[model samples]
Target: MKKAIGKAFLAITGWKGEGAPPEHGRYVLIAAPHTSNWDFPFTLAFAWAYGVEMRWMGKHTLFEGPKGWFFRAVGGVPVIRHERRSMVQQMVDLFTEHDRLALVVPAEGTRSLVPHWKSGFYHIARGANVPVVLGYLDYSRKTGGFGGLLEPTGDMRADMDRVRAFYADKVGKFPEKFGPIRLKEELEADEIAAAKLAS
Candidate 1:
């Protein structure tokens, strides 16, 4: 039923799916170039089409109200951003407790432009000893799907380079709102170097 619904939705929307989800029992799935709200529904449809059940974290407020049941039923996990607790640690613990868990995270953290991507996905995958699955939505081709699994080796720059390469050709709904895929620390360093050169 879900697979049929997913296929129908994609067909009606004129979108195509590519690649496959990770075959591993446990992994962190990170989606990128999330520059529009439509990315969520499109991603959900792709997940259903592929028959991959994934749990995704969202703002705690999204889990409230009458519609909360719908969100929870569809594998939505509420995350309290204001809480001091380490989200990466919490995710790692969840991975530890569950025999098979696929936690999906939007590395961009928001549907707006930012200097760099949040590293929570990398930290969570590393701490949990799981691979990172590269999930993407390429608006240019009107296609959405997973790319491949990346094993985090604690080399942030090197790992991010591969991530950047994968998303290089992919276009977001709002391309202007999608910044280069780099770590915050690396972006800051580049800014500092540029400032020094100007001075």
Candidate 2:
């Protein structure tokens, strides 16, 4: 019933996806182009269509009433982002507790452009000794997809560069939704700009 409902909703909303089913593993699933609220439901529909059951984290505040019940049924887990708890430690605990689970996390962490992406996804994958699955929502093609699994090697900067390069030319149907990838030089320049502004 859940899968049928999700598929039907996607069809009605004209949401299209092109990803292969996610494999079962202890993985950090990173969804891209998270530029809108609708991405969540769209991605959920796509996941359901592929019959891939994944547990994803969201801010604790989003859980409420019947909606919360529904999200829980669909494998939603609340993450207290503001807590002092180390994200790496939390992921280690979760992966340790749940065997062979795919913990989906949004690498961008928001619908807006930032100087850089949240590194928790990288840290979680490394700490848990799992693969990182790069999931994408290319609004340009009205499509979504996932690449082959990637295992983090603890070299943060190098690993991120590899990941970014993989998706660089992957055109989306909604080009406007795609954000610019801040290159290493761009990151340093942004930091310098921020420092100047602060002074």
Candidate 3:
């Protein structure tokens, strides 16, 4: 019934999905090029259409009020942004607790253009021992859905290279508001490479 509603919603909005959802029962599902508020409902719509009971992390404050249960009912997991590394650990622990979890992480962290993506998704996938799946929104084509599956090799650059390739052609609703698909951790990868050359 919910899947039917989701599919109808997408059809009504004239937004269609591209590929099938990932087969992994437990993994980090990243929604990329997230530059607009509309991404939330559309992402949810796709999840329903694909039969993925996807859970997303939202600001903890959102879960504090009377509507908290509503949010949780729709698969929202409250997160305190300032917790940083601890938040990653908590998400990893959640994966341990649930036998089948599809956590949708918005890598951009906000609607505006950002310099780099938060690395928490990468860390969570690695720590949870689950593959990372790319969920994309290409407003240019009026299409969006899961793209590629990446198994972390602990080599940040190599793993991210696969991520980069998948999103290269994905365009956001606000194209100017979308920055490069990069993680701040890649800078550390750069430093490691530089050090090896110097030594």
Candidate 4:
């Protein structure tokens, strides 16, 4: 029923998916160019269309209300973003516990522009000893699906370069809001320097 609903949603919206979802038992799925609210529903539809039951994290508060049960039923996990807990290790432990887990993370972290992407997804995949599947939603083409997988080599710069290349051609709903996909460390220094100069 979910699969059929996903297909119908895509068909009605005039959107098509390209590649198949990951066939592996465990991996980190990172979606890019998440610049609009529409990305969420489109992503859910794409996943269901491919018969992929993916787990995604939401703020802990989202899991506290009446609709919380519905969210959990759809694979939503509560995450305490402001806590000091080691999220990467927690995710790694989840991989260890589950024989098959495909965790979906939106690297951009927000719909508005940011200087760099959050590196939590990369760390989670690396710590869990799993591949990172590149998921994309290209609004220009009305297409969305997995692109491919990346095996982290502990080389942050090179690995992120490949990620940027993969998403280079993918267009988001708000193109101006999508910045280059770079590491947080790389951009933090620039942000700090800019702040210093402004003072």
Per-prediction tally of clashes: 0, 6, 0, 0
- For residues 85-170, write the lDDT of model 1, one tens digit per residue: 77787788889898888898999899989878999999999999999999999999899998978999988888988998898998
- For model 3 the TM-score comes to 0.91
How do the residues 89-149 of candidate 2 rate in per-residue lDDT, one tens digit apiece? 7777889997677777877676776556777777788888888888887765666767767
Q: What is the C-alpha RMSD of each candidate to the true structure, in Å?
A: 1.9, 4.1, 2.4, 3.1
Instruction: Name the better of 2 and 4 by lDDT.
Output: 4
lDDT digits (tens) for residues 121-166 of candidate 4: 9999989999999999999999999997899998887898899889
Model 3 / residue 143 / CA error / Å: 0.9
> Positional deviation of 177 in candidate 3, in angstroms?
1.1
Residue 89 CA displacement from its true place in model 4, Å? 1.9
